[model samples]
Target: MTLLADRHGRTFPYLRLSLTEACNYRCSYCLPDGWRADGGPRFLDADEVRRLVSAFAGLGMWKIRLTGGEPSLRKDLTAIIATVAATPGVRKIALTTNGCRLSRHLPRWRAAGLTALNVSLDSLDRERFRAITGRDRHDDVLAGVDQALAMGFDAVKLNAVLLRGINDDELPRWLDWLRDRPLALRFIELMRTGDNGEYFERHHLGADVIEDRLRAAGWTPCPRAPDAGPAREYSHPDYAGRIGLIAPYSKDFCVGCNRLRVTARGDLRLCLFGDFGVPLRPLLREDGQRDELMQRIRALLGHKAAGHFLHEGKTGITPHLASVGG
Candidate 1:
């Protein structure tokens, strides 16, 4: 019962837990322009989350990632980290944030057993940053990066979602910025999700373009041991860690995808591109339903698709990425 293999025969050992669906910045790639403030989400209670992590660990999952509209926004983040760290089989605990709130939580987070950090940053220019994230905190994010490194976080990844007309031309510049730094620079393909579909059509740049630009900039693709996710990692000939191109949209990583997600509200999602998800909260709340839920999870994984159809013009979740924990 601890190990559940998917239809593709891949067993998932990682789980992405979305702490909340709330966010401060209305990024062009996530939320659209003229978005309303609809704060009507049922976030999982802290205790419930603890129980879920414990159960997942009992089920053979060892790597856990706390993500969100902004996971750093969760009030009990440190407590959640501590609880998951105590889980039996759990080996890795990480968080992905927009970098707007990372610096403030670095010291405390590291002390609580959180191991890795992935920061979302699109552009380096002040005006462009503001235009992209609908905020003027580019400097704040940069400082946050410095603060995270100074605090000794194991790995600090800078996530850049590349859009074609928007920031594609700045690829080399971004690479140069991280050339001397040890942090991993991840370039995410502009995914078709949320209200930001407009940018998908305008800013979608495949990994090939990114790779070509990196080579033209005199950077070599340092080979990496195979990794999970869509990003094909490459590094400067002499750079420390490496840069990764996550082409989730342009090039789906579903074939080797061995990860599943449980939304803050308790929905079990098999794939990021899949539309339907079974609600696990009801089962988790009932002891008698525990076995039933596990069976459902197994069945779901058995039906998992080989990969997502991102290149076939699929935009937005049948339920939107925000609802699906993108």
Candidate 2:
């Protein structure tokens, strides 16, 4: 099978599928005022998701990540995982969740072919966590992290969006806390996408400063870990796991971006920071149109932007991170 390569020759083998636009947390950076999925198509059923996954896998997609406002909020997540796992070309299945409802579903999800996890955790302090996420489930999220580590998932990554004056002071504490763990801690730079331009301007902290702090504090850069994603990984000589920095703002991390995002509403987003997407629900709903659907998908892939223009001060690509399956 031919790989899904864009005009820039970037072969997209990974797919990020948004299961739902609904989330329980009102993260200040992601969704400050909270979100409600009262109207429109709220979510795709397990079978619909399975068909879509199969279609992408058939196009030589190897890795699949289930994302959402909070993927764990979906009751049929395991079923979706099972279906994706059963697809022929899908080599790995991963999840990105807020971890609020992860503890109860970890084992089942693992058994259903969840090979890895990326839990969103911004702050370690209980009150600070509550303040950041607008929810008081910090301990619960930590418990989910602990459970994931205990369960020995192949790759358990912690994703923290570093914001100035919000969770920046906890960088040292974050490094110390993960010293004895086998999970990877990624500190993401704030991006000015969606409706958070003002919020980003106020709190955006670049990864350069964070790296400088780490280096000044004696965190040596170890050999790079094996991964295809965007994190620039590092480690302390005495630490068990590694530290990563995803600086999309201060630095361009999209040179080799090989992925596509499918929103919960079935829009095929060729570029995360692009303003346009192809509506895929209509094709998916039409039976006996897999061939045509695949063709349309391939054609859209050709239109993938060379790179996100956010570094050039482009905005309005997306309204919110939740809508873009962040």
Candidate 3:
């Protein structure tokens, strides 16, 4: 069996699958005006998703994360979760969302075998959150996080886009909140996408902003796991939660890239900021095509680039993070 290893000796043990391109929040850093019509094909159906995960599972991919503008918009989301969970080699099932509907659907989602969660929570202040997301669901999102904490998930991560002149100074508020919650809070440095260049320039805060504060406040670096996401985590004895920084601009950020992303339309992205995507949906129609599907993916891995060129102002075809499951 061929492991999903690239030419650089980097292997992918995790996959991020986009279920839908639809999202509710118009996040300032992402879908500021909400999800727009991209005129692309419809998202993968349940059966297509099953075949997709099955092929990846056979290639030693153990972790599958369902991402989207918001995954809950799909009516068959529970079915999607069950399908991924049932795949033989897949060990973890996770989802990343804006958390507006988390509490409403969490009980069923967990019952369907979902294990971990990542919620986009850009602000701690109610009004600020509303301003950033263009929705008044701050209380709803926090309530969902609280419920997820009590539900015995493997882990629940809170993601905040570090924006200058916005939520950048809320680290103290986050630390105070994390003091008692057993959550993993991540501060992701804002990245430049195709349509958000001007916005990115204005709001993009260096992750060092948080790293410096974490160090000054006595947060020590924590060892990373083999299949962990691109987060440099830190912990402190007094705090119950952990803090992480997902800074793509960092010198060595892509050294531990262990995952691949599939867009909602079934296009495989080698690098989030890669210049091209290979369409995989054509081979995902039947179980009998598993061999060809895996082979196609294995061959493409050899072409995977060492890293992204966001520093050069080239964001590929990614108009927004939601489109490619970012």
Among the numbered candidates, top TM-score falls to: 3
Q: Look at candidate 3 and give me any clashing residue pairs.
A: none
What residue runs in model 3 are displaced by over 4 Å at the alpha carbon? none
Per-prediction CA RMSD (Å): 2.5, 1.8, 0.9
Candidate 3 per-residue lDDT over residues 120-218, each given as its tens digit: 999999999999999999999999999999999998999998999988888888999999999999999999998898998898889998899899999
Give the Å error, residue 52, model 2: 1.0
lDDT of all predictions: 0.75, 0.83, 0.92
Q: Which of the two, 1 or 3, has more TM-score?
A: 3
Summarize candidate 2's per-residue lDDT along 1-326 as a digit string, tens digits: 77888877678788999998888889888788898766787577776687788788879888999998788878888888888888898888999999988778899999999999999988889999899899999888899999999987889999999899888889778877988998889899887876788898899888988889878877776564323577877877778888888887654477768789999988899877887878888877745777877888888887777778887778646877888676
Clashing pairs in 1: 163-203, 164-203, 231-246, 317-320
lDDT per residue as tens, model 1, 26-79: 787776452343676568887778777776776778888888878877888999
Q: Pick the candidate with the highest lDDT.
A: 3
Q: Could you tell me the TM-score of candidate 3?
A: 0.98
